[model samples]
Target chain A: MDIRTLCLGILALGDATGYEIKKMVAEGSFSFFSEASYGSIYPALTKLTTEGLIECRQESQSNRPDKKIYSLTEAGRAALEDSLAKDPRPDKNRSEFLASLLFAEAVAPERINSLVQDRITSHKRQIDALKLMRAEEDSPVGQFVLDYGIQVQQAAYDFLIANKGRIVTKL
Target chain B: MDIRTLCLGILALGDATGYEIKKMVAEGSFSFFSEASYGSIYPALTKLTTEGLIECRQESQSNRPDKKIYSLTEAGRAALEDSLAKDPRPDKNRSEFLASLLFAEAVAPERINSLVQDRITSHKRQIDALKLMRAEEDSPVGQFVLDYGIQVQQAAYDFLIANKGRIVTKL
Candidate 1:
């Protein structure tokens, strides 16, 4: 998804700073499905403001950079709706773990082991976080997306644990 | 997964024309994980050739554009391995379906219903394709990634089928 469209959707929920937008993407159940870095988010916000799809207001902060609170304009809301109406691009799974495993023969056994262990740990944490967010969901969309995250993460964790030895031994 | 790294990985398999490379990406198991347009692939191939990471040989063809088949060099292989050693970016799922469902209230009831049905149908097809690919897998990495795809796609399909009514009716 375009970052501009994503920013509009998040702002529709209420006002937020770029940091808050990044935070929401990182910690929210939505994070399971998507993420945005400040690298992309700040530039997206600037572009959206230029295109007049969103409005921002400055707020002074103590001992920190001033926050730019962003909100969706009517145009932004309409654009988001239009984006929704269009066909969604297929979901992609570009795991570095998978890519590395394709060349496992060249990697040190310990390195493959560490990578597998890291993936298991990460998957477990994501599953836990998704479960936690799911506990509070009142929206169908939230519930559905959260459940999707839990299912995929659990499957991944199980695969990692079950196959770790195969990969590690081969390295 | 940067496109440049992805291209290097493909070349690791064998030599192929840029057009052939695009076909491999679109038709192979990698289809679910990544994509590139001819626009990007041609330019990337030229740059890689100039940088000495890859070597290309031109082959004359009948009634078609001459093909430039690219093969990875020792340096290219080293670069690819280096990229693999680095932390791979997590998989991203930018689902406009979920985004649209978030605003189910604004969409027409029929439109929401149609979208849900279309998504479920499309997911089912993808799951079937993943299963077929799984049947043809020969390596551990292929087996692992195929399993991952099947599990994720099945979970998504099940969720959409089970929750379509709850979401669409809210429109």
Candidate 2:
């Protein structure tokens, strides 16, 4: 989905500043399946505000710039609901690791070992983070998505460990 | 990796027309982890040829227009090797399915069931296709990557089937 639709969905939960929206996407539950940077989020928020799907109010700060708190309008809620009703595009697993592995013959065995080892470590870290998130998530849907992430990452981690020797030794 | 690098990698396998390169990405072994469209591939091919990374020759077809076959140059092989030596970016799992499920409360229970069911079917199909590819693959690295794809897809498929009720019933 587009960042605008995602922003509307985030606001549907509660009012948030653009910074809060970016944080929610980058470091929160949505981090696993979606992405939005400040560059894209601010533009999306602005457009959503202009289109009347969302409204922004400036909260004054004593020592800092005013915080623009954004909340969903009735139209925004409708739009989010409408988006959920439509069929989502299929998942895309864009793994540069896997693509690089496709050319494994070109690299040294040491390079292959290091790459797989790094991936194993990365997956472990992600699984741990998801577990932490799982403890804090009370919603069934939230827990379900977390479990999905953990399961898939675990499978990949296990596969890499089990199969690393196959590629490394062959090189 | 960029499409230009990918194109070079494909030609590393053998000389192929742009159509063949597109097919290899869309339907061949690379389908699961990479993507390229004609719109992007053609420009990359043009740029690569100009840069002396690849060379293309036009062969007249019997009934259709002349077909351009591209092959990697010495520089292209060197470039592909250079890319392999660098660290790959981490994988990105952009799943609209999971993202939609995150806001499951906004949609109907039936919609949730149908979405999950469709995902299950897609994963099953992917697993079957990957298995077929695995049989045809002779290289250990090729088999390794295919196995990774199948295992992960199986994990996702199983997860959705087992957890569909959790989200649907709550909604």
State the DockQ, from 0 to 1, for candidate 2.
0.70
lDDT of 1 by residue, B68-87 (tens): 88998999988987887787
> iRMS for model 2?
1.7
lDDT per residue as tens, model 1, A9-90: 7887678999998998887766766688999999999999999999999999899899899988888888877777787776
> What is the CAPRI rating of model 1's predicted complex?
acceptable
Per-prediction DockQ, in order? 0.43, 0.70
Q: Say which candidate scores most in DockQ.
A: 2
Per-residue lDDT over A31-109 for candidate 2, one digit per residue giving the tens place of the 0 to 100 score = 9988889999999899999999999999999999899999989888878888888888988888888877776554334
Give Cα-based local distance difference scores for all models: 0.76, 0.85
Q: Would candidate 2 be rated incorrect, acceptable, medium or high by CAPRI criteria?
A: medium
Q: Ten consecutive residues with minimal summed lDDT in candidate 1 chain A?
A: A101-110
lDDT of 2 at A129: 96
Q: Among these predicted structures, which one has the highest lDDT?
A: 2
